[model samples]
Target: MTDSTAERRHELSSFLRARRERTSPSDVGLPGTPRRRTPGLRREELANLAGISTTWYTFLEQGRDVRPSLQVLTAIADALRLGEPERAHLIMIAADETHPGEDSEYLAPEVADVPKMVNPNPAYVTGSSYDLLAWNDAAVELFPGAIDAAKPNLARWIFTNPAARDALPDWPVVAQGLLARLRTNAGKHPGSPRFQRLERELRTSSPEAEAWWPRYDIATSQAGAKRVRSRSGQEQLMTYASFHVSDQPEQILTIYRPA
Candidate 1:
């Protein structure tokens, strides 16, 4: 098997095990017993819940060369009581599905102009890995030094930059959300060099990233409100939404307006 395939299998195995251990029997409507030694539902219990053989499920958890159909995976997801994001992440890794716009990195001039068009609002365009591809004056004012960096990545800035804590009033919560989104993206693009490098940098530089990486959290980016401190140290509530570039799906245009 290729290195990427092996790495993906390992990730799949680890993610499954983590989710399984966190899911309690009571959570799945199974009677809980004090006699249970395992942290959560037993392997056989999960297998039965999913209508699969215990041995097969065990092999899958062990990262054996077992190919599970989509239907089976769905059944297992239901048994595990995984959320939508978690279910999508599981399917992406287990089935080794290729993400859309995995190789394309070309950003059209028109697409790059989107942020500037959204004048007064803090707007920026990011690549699939959250790299700051383009930003407007408002965005620069909102995020000082970030847009000026040689390789400005949102995730990297959130985790490694000390200024991020001051800029974001709720830094921990925001960081976790960003990390979860990154995790979901990582699942979609397994063995991506850019992602690998970013993960390594985060884990090495930030204690929170190191501790949270193994949790295997997954999240889809969504419209939300955030409290940001401007360069004047004035706190402001902003509503943010992201739009996918029609032609280049990997390029995301995010705009923040006063809430």
Candidate 2:
């Protein structure tokens, strides 16, 4: 197998292990044994619950050459009690298809002008890795140095930058959502070098990031209301929505308007 394929398989195995370890027999209405040595449900128990062979599940967890079908994946996801986003992430990780790397998508001219077009409203465009590609003047006003050419990562800025707490009054909620988005994207793009780099940086830079990374929470960007601390020291609520760029679905166009 190629390096990328191997990496994808390994990631799938790790994701499954993490999910399995977090779920307990009691959670799934299974009998709890007194002498159980495993922290969560055992591999064999999970396989049985999913109606698959224990040997097959073992091979899958071992990152062997066995490929699972969508039906099997669905069963396993149900057995593990995965949420919608988590199930989607699991399917992406387990797929054998070859996905495009970073070079496949580029910021088009029209796409670049989107943030500028949405004037007065705080707008920005970010890549799948949450790298800030473009931002409007309003976005900069709301977030000082948010449009900086250097240090433009949303995740890095949220976790490591002290000013983030001041800008985002609801820091805890926003941080969790960002982390969940990262987890979802990581599964979709398993071999992405940008993701690997950011993962390392987040895990090393902030204690909160390190603690939350293992939880494997997943989130998809959608329209939502956010509360921010304005320059006048007043709490301002803004509504935001994410738009997908043509041919570059990973390039996220986010626009924030007064709520």
Candidate 3:
């Protein structure tokens, strides 16, 4: 299989495994068994609940060449109790191929300009893989040298940039959150070259990042607060909100405001 196909298969398998692991036997109305080695429902249990053969489900989880029908996917999703985003992502990965047309990764000029419009709020736009597509003056002022990296990769900056660690007082918390968000981005767009490149770079360059990657912590874009240290060495809390760009669904507009 090609790299894209292989990536899709890997993502599908990983997604299934993650979701399955998160769902417990009790959550699915099954009795907890002491013999269970895993935390969640076993493959056989999930297969039985989904009305499919254990062998087939196991094959799917193993990233084997198996195409599950829509009905089968829906059944498995229900059995795993996937949320709407998770369910949509599941369907997307299970598909043979994504829609072919324009490049979904491309951020339009208007979309890129969105951050500028949000001025003074420290707004920036990130692509699906968390690449810094665009940012306003406030973002540059707040993030400092970190965002001006050669690649301007958010994940890279979080783990590798000394300035980022200094600027964000809660470095460990921010780094962990960034890693979790990166994992989510990777899962959502497994075939994205940008994500793949960043992943490889991080794995090789940042030991801290490599160690945290396997946790498979998934994070969604949401409003939150961040504690940051200013250039003057004064610390302050900042509240941030994430907005999905309607024109470019893959791009997110994040604005950080003073708390």
Candidate 4:
């Protein structure tokens, strides 16, 4: 007997979540009830809209024993009002496909254009995984050796680079959070060239990093206070707000404000 495996079921689950939360009943043509217990559409409602059975929708959301056809996936995508990037992400996740080559060149200029003039507060843009791709003068000045686009990557610097150790005062606390995020990304993109490159780079560069890498077990980063030591001897603790750039699939906008 052969064991059937689930593929892209996680992606389908993710797509379902992102879809339902994005639309309220009023946003679509569905009736809104103040007494409704669920925050978003019920499984029955989603099935009704997608022209499928509630049991089938439950299986899809449960990520159980399902290999949805492209036509069916397209129907779900359309029903969810998914934009191009969101649609593509749903498709890729469902297929369990990897796009490392496309993923590598993140932080396109259009996604987060550098200001003609630098601001007082330090800021930068990275990929979805917080891989620092670009920063302005203020960001560069704030962390003397922080943004080196040529070999700049947040994960590598956080785990391997010593200069980064100095720039970020609370390394011990932040490293755990950062590595957990990398762990999740790695699972999604196993054997990817860039991911492998970063993994190897960290392993070779820091044995401490290698020891801790395998134990990481989380996907998202928490909005915690980040502190950095300034050259003048005081610490610059700040609030970091992370935003996803809608048009560019892999870009993020991060702004730092003084604490």
Candidate 3 residue spans exceeding 4 A from truth = 99-105
lDDT values for all models: 0.86, 0.86, 0.82, 0.66
Ranking by TM-score: 1, 2, 3, 4
Ranking by lDDT: 2, 1, 3, 4
Q: How close is every model to the real structure, measured as TM-score?
A: 0.93, 0.92, 0.85, 0.59
> Can you tell me which runs of candidate 4 are displaced by over 4 Å?
1-95, 114-118, 128-130
Cα displacement (angstroms), candidate 1, residue 103, comes to: 8.8
| Per-residue lDDT of candidate 3, residues 1-259 (tens digit) | 8667778888888778877887889998988877878868889999999999999999999999999999999999899887776677678778888432222367788888888898878998887777788898999889878577765867778777788888999998888887877787677665676677788888888888888776566667889999988888889899999999887666788899999
> How accurate locally is residue 226 in candidate 3, as Cα lDDT from 0 to 100?
98
Residues 142-256 of candidate 4 have per-residue lDDT tens digits of 6666566576777777776677778778887777777756755654554455666777888788877777665433445335478987767678788877666677744666667
Summed over model 2, clashes come to 0
Residue 36 in model 2: lDDT: 78
**TM-score for candidate 2:** 0.92
What are the per-residue Cα lDDT tens digits for candidate 2 across 192-227? Answer: 777888899999999999999888777888999999
Candidate 1 lDDT over residue span 65-169, tens digit each: 898999999999999999887888898899764433343367889988988898999999888788888899999888776777887888899999888998999
Against the true structure, what is every candidate's RMSD?
A: 2.1, 2.0, 2.9, 9.6
Q: Per-residue lDDT for 225 in model 3?
A: 99
Give the range where candidate 4 is weakest over 10 consecutive residues by summed lDDT.
1-10
